[model samples]
Target: MQVELNSVWQVNGVDGLEKALYRVLQLYMKQRVVILFPLSDSKALLRPVKIDFDNFSEAIKVGNARPSRYDLPYYQLQYDDEISREHLTKRDEKYTLIVDLVSNPDFLLSFVERPRSKLVSLHAKTHNTYVQNIYRALNLYWKYAQERNALLPGYKNSGGRGKARVAGEIKRGSPIQLSSSSIEAPKGVNTSESDKELFIKAMKKFGLRGEEVKFSRVYDKMLKEYYAEELISAEAESREAKVPNYRAFIYWVKKLIPTDTLIRKQTNQGDFDRNKRGLRGAATDHTEGPGSCFELDATVLDVHIVSDFQRNHVLGRPTVYCVVDKESRMIVGLHVSLEYASWRAGRQALINSFTSKKEYCAQFDIEIEESEWPCSHIPLRLLCDRGEFICKDAENLAVPLIGHLSIAPPYRAELKGIVEHRFNILNEKLVHELPGTTKGKQYDRSVKDPRLDATFTLREITKLLIDEVLEHNSSIFQDLAKQSILLIESGLSPTPLNYWNQHVKAQRHALSKADEVHVRSRLLPTTKVTMTGKGIRLNDQMYFESDHPDFDAWKIIARNNGSWSLDALVDHDNSSLLYVRLEEEGSFIKCYLKKESANFANRHQADILFFKDWVKLEKNKAKPSAKSIERHNRKKQVIESAIEDTKLEPKVGSKSKRTKGMKARRREAILAQRLEESGAKPDQEYSSVNSEQSSQRIDDDRKKVISILKRKKVTDNET
Candidate 1:
């Protein structure tokens, strides 16, 4: 077999051989060639060798040159040179070549035998096509090795037939693939449009730094859903169908909605035509003053006062009754309570909102005392729901104090839309959004109790209320007010104090001391007490005369409920009692006692014990010790006499045997009486026994009985 050049190229013998081998390898690497060869002396010398460069074969035919019987094998000579090893060349450019021929058989037999290509011929000669092809591959590998050696720096071996072994160190270093630096993209090339957009938007909205937001695995998925699926292709002209993934679709949808949105629509009552017809901006013009548009609304708190003593002085979360200024959006007054929402709450809220001196001055920066300020320029036009709290007054008595005139949104709630709108904003922006809430105090307000995990104490709740108030009052609202006062103060603008001073003025039309006194009188305590025919008796005091106005009126004097030390009302002011008439006790006398203290003495302790236990008892059940008094009264006459005798002498210790015996007999009689009282009957003969006969049971009984009878006789005679 002979190899032919596919493409002719110019070179010397060895160089041509190397070039030819390289071409073959290039074809083999490209999977183009099936076989390769080194130039053969003649066809017979061409035999297979290993494919590696070390075993590459360059063939030479000596048809009659091997005539001697002792001639070394011709096949052995084929591998004498580096180019004769195999079918292809192997590149190991870093290594240097060194050949050692082992002429001594003894050293060759050892495990450390060195190669001496001229001496031994161990491999068998075979003409197998597969083996021959392997040889061709080895020769081709040699060509690449020689070329690599030529290009490698500091390589020394040249034009030698000796085999080369790797020398020095292979370095044991990692390949070029090992790297520490991140793969940086080219300058100005941003790969993620979606990420950049999100980062920018977030930075703008939240005032966050760009680097503060990072892209997690979730961001990738979001991008795929939003940009890949949901965003309208401006290229196409219609809204796209939603993606299957809920979170991604929701994200896109959320982005579409305005971040801060306000919606105002007419209710079932229809358009607010009255205001519409008057002026283009009549609402603003009318609400020009501080008190111009009074906004009244109820805020229900989750806090409640837990009266269940088992829980102890727990303050319940409270709901707030709020009245705000429509023009300023400032909270006018807040009445917090645990009671259900009512006109009373609203009225009280209204009162509190308008009354505070601080609220009036909040709009202005200049410090002004209450005396210096004037009444609010705006009329006290009240705005609120048409609920009972706003309408009722004859019963709660708060109606007359509310205001001169009030206007409610008649069918269309949007007429008084400011308060309602403010409530929603305030809840999300303040109350509901607050952390760490608690119970309400017994302040006679109507706040509810919050649950335990989030329940804040009354003090905590109060502080939170104040904090929210400050936030609402001083906070920069985006829509109502053009710029956020809070954010502005943080950066470009002055403090809220400065803003108020510059734009707003203090309003002074607050309640006077006299008005406060009158308001206090309305809330005075008027407890009911029974009347005697002679005078109005309170407790045991009797001083008022029948002619007094209060005597027949069944009257009471009004006083502040907080004064626990004050005595009951009486007609005779000179007689110490405030309202009692100056007269004697009439045909019948009436006594007044605390409802909790009116009970029999014998069971007093148990009654108190019952009181102590009352908090633990189930509702609507009579106490366990209710009849304890009846049980104590079942005592014998002798025991009763002994008790009276002991009381007379006041002895601390040492009683006579007769006295002890009488006491024992009394105890037995008491037990018997108790049994009867408990619905049991005794034998009749036991009751009829004489005292003398009973004395036979104990000698001391006679003496004790004699002493008792003698004392009784003397007492009877004296009477």
Candidate 2:
């Protein structure tokens, strides 16, 4: 029978032994074989024997001839080079020692052929280095068919890990020293089962709660409550207590309680889940490539900025929204607005991500090539926190624009860590370095007020943010963990822009082209606007007029009937234009702000709203002022005096008689009043001209009265 080297053969029913297993180590001339026998006893050394192939075959055949027949060609072979090499790599010291000793031909031959004592003598004499346990090394080499890694020390099984020791009569730890020689120090007792129960109860009372208690405080509370008798005695006698020490209490606490449970019990669930949870994977784990997924988040910037319209008026800190690509760590879009961190500001950021950066930068007087900030396509998936993306408006607006919308759980900001981290990067790079930055600690802020140092306007800060984003995209990222084989082979620098460009060049990007107009319409928030006789009105302050043919017809309908309202998508960043949805699907009419609402144009919607609120506040403040009250009282007195004068007038003869020739009476009263005010008599020649003119005016008035009476008579006859 043919036998392979390193294969194990079992000979059962042997003459002297019940069974014997031998590994074929080497094959010599004339079918001679060198084999190793691994004994069942672990303490016994491995036995190596050389025998002829015919004899080995006969022993196997004899075993097959027994009543309880055994297989003739029994072989058990198991050897893995990869596993053995891995084992060797784990223990460098043992592996190196074994390899150095075995490298010598004379030592290796003697180790395998000679007896244990002889091999040890040879090793001691030939080499200056000495192995403490040569027999153990030999046995390991022979047992594993001469594999070097089997000689490694079994340190993993050496220590009695996870095994607890029972407490003995003696004290567990060293005794404490006493300050006074008269008072003897007490030996601390071991933590018994009852003591462990007390410790657990104390921990539950003090340590295991949402409100965090310091370790020392917990120990004090435990001593005061659980070991009050011992503490009192020690205090009265001025000696240490015989109870378990703080060390033993802590050991038992750690042993009995799991780390996860301890942390969970001592922290708020939301804070623990958001800030202290283990991160199993990355945001880019599911992303295919650049543009595959985008993370969106917003934060109030740390720097104060002035209003763009009024530079002297500080607008406070602006809310900045960032959209980051998960794969490349690129800031695909950014928006700085005076609005709060709401969906309104978030949607503007999304719109910036979906549109061309060239035009966006141009608006801020920043010139850059399209290649510098090439991100302009919608991603397959969008991730955001619950603050801005959890509402119905966000769902309605965002669901149609992307393939999937991932709204992270409340208070879990780590889910959108890519964008959250980008906010930090921007703040550190630009915002914190700028003037009027509220970046220092509260105590340190007593030095100077950041608001008083405000210099940049909203537009200026926005431009700086854009510049910073561009610089960040081009800067090298050292912590980039994931890299494709092609990318590495190409030897490209690790920059977000480079990663993006390489992915696009290799056609491995997940960018989807979308019409800018459609994306803008979908991303912008929509509000109900009333179509009035003048124009479409937003928030009862801003009016927009559309030039569409139906606009005039709709205005006429609103004039005759009551005004109707429709949903119009509005960009809060600019109130100059609004997108009014028409009856046709996917059709929107551009509505320009009317001349009446011109004051609101070219300003943010938030700014206009703030101005209106300020106006109302001023009006309310003036209502209770002394000057306003005095003016109101004066007007009331004047009206009452005029009513008293009217009451003093003479009574009229009859209703018809009093009403007769009322126009002539009113002319004569006006003339007398004008003449009395001038205090002058009319000249004779001027009176003649006035008489002629009055006669002509009388003739003209008579003709107008006849025309009106004839017309009224005809209308009454027709009726």
Candidate 3:
């Protein structure tokens, strides 16, 4: 049989096999072998001895020799390099020193050949060491496997790690010392089962609730309730109670309750689930490559920004929406506006992500190549929180634009951690350093007002953010956990832009090109507009007109019949234009604000809504005015006076008398009323001149005036 050298072999079914096993230590060239009784207590059996190889084989054949299933002795195995001498404790150092001396080949050979006691004495004399040290080393080397780790002191196993001490009458710790004779020394008490029960009761009442309570308070309550008699007696005697101390109570509490269980019991469910839960996976694990998935989230910027129209007016914090590619960690799109975190503001961010960045940056006077920020494609999936995307309006995006929409569970923000983490980066790196940042604690911010120090307008901050995003895209990311083989072979740095470009070049990206107009139309918020005779009315105030061939006919029909309503999509940022859907499957027609709604033109939907609210408020404020009350009172008086006048007038006796000479009476009454209005007498006569008589009179008057003027002109010429 082939046997490995320096390996232990067990001989089963031997004479003493039941009591102990024998190990084959070495094979000699003279057909002999050395056998060691490794587990023997007799010193003679512990020593190695040579036996006839033929006899050993016959014995093994009957006993069934096999490799040793148990671990080998210390001298047979290699030493561990990780066991450093400098880090070993004092006990371990002593063991290591003995192991080092015995590990020498000369010492091992001498140990196997000579008597152990005599060998130890010789080694001690030769090395000028203690005899007991050599003997201890010899015993330890034979007992454990010949490895450095076997020499390590068993300090970890020495102490009772988790065992609880039984309470006794006397304390099991150091005695208390007193500095003054008048003051009494504290007699510490061991925690009994009853005392532990009290501690558990106190924790359950105070510490195990959603509202957090201090351990000191809990201990105080326990002393007041459970140890009331002991406390009173101790206070009367000017001494402490002979009960378990606060430290023992805390220890028992920890021993009874686990840390995670305590946390779950002492905090609100929402807080625990959101802030204290463990993260099992990463956002990038779900993403395929760049543009495979995008995370969208909105946050109110910490710094207050001024209005774009008026620099001095602080518009408070602006809500900024960011769209980040999960795999590349690139901020693909952004939208900063005064609008709150809603669908209206969120859709703008989606639009920006679907449109080119070159044109978007040009609006802010930033010129850049398309390659610098080339993230204009729609992703395969979109992930967002439940705030904005959990609505019917968001369906427009899912049905037409992107492949799938993922709404994160409520109170779990880690699912969209990519965009959420980007918001933190923006705040910490840029926003916190701005002039009007509310980044400090409430007490720290009491010295000055951040709002008053506001310096950046919305447009200016947006431009700065655009630049920041570009810089971020180009910056090196150190925490990339995974890289593809192609990326590694290319030896490219881990930057968002580089990753994105490489993936796109390799056609590994899930990016999809979409028409900008179609994206905008689908992303805009939809509402119903009424087609009326005047124009198409929105929100019963703003009006729009369409140039489609059917628009005129629809208007005419609306005028003759009742007004009809059609589904229209409106851009909340601009109230000047709208997209009206006339048919179910047809494309949306572009509509502009009509002249009738000119007051609302070139204004935002929010501004128009605010104006309408202000008008309503003003009307409400003027409803109960003094002038209105007086006008109503005067109207009542006029009706009463007219009623009295009609009562005083004589009544007609028959219908025939009332209808007699209707036309003549009407003409007389009209002429009389005209004469009265002209301030003429009641008996004044009116004459009507014929056209022929009027012409004859005009000719006579013209001849008389011509003769007078000719005489005057002749006299002037003679003078």
Listing every candidate in turn, what is its Cα RMSD in Å to the true structure after a full C-alpha superposition?
Answer: 35.4, 10.2, 11.8
How many clashing residue pairs, candidate 2?
0
The 10-residue segment with the lowest total lDDT in model 3: 684-693
The best-first sequence of candidates by TM-score reads: 2, 3, 1
Q: Can you give the TM-score per candidate against the true fold?
A: 0.32, 0.65, 0.62
Best of the two (1, 3) by TM-score? 3
lDDT of each: 0.39, 0.75, 0.75
- Better-scoring candidate (TM-score), 2 or 3: 2
Candidate 3 lDDT (Cα, whole model)? 0.75
lDDT of 3 by residue, 76-154 (tens): 3434454445434543655645755545545544455566447556656776778766555554445454444454544
Candidate 2 or 1, higher TM-score: 2
Give the least accurate 10-residue stretch of model 2, judged by summed lDDT.
67-76
Clash pairs, model 3 backbone: 73-145, 73-146, 74-144, 74-145, 74-146, 75-146
lDDT of model 3 at position 425: 85
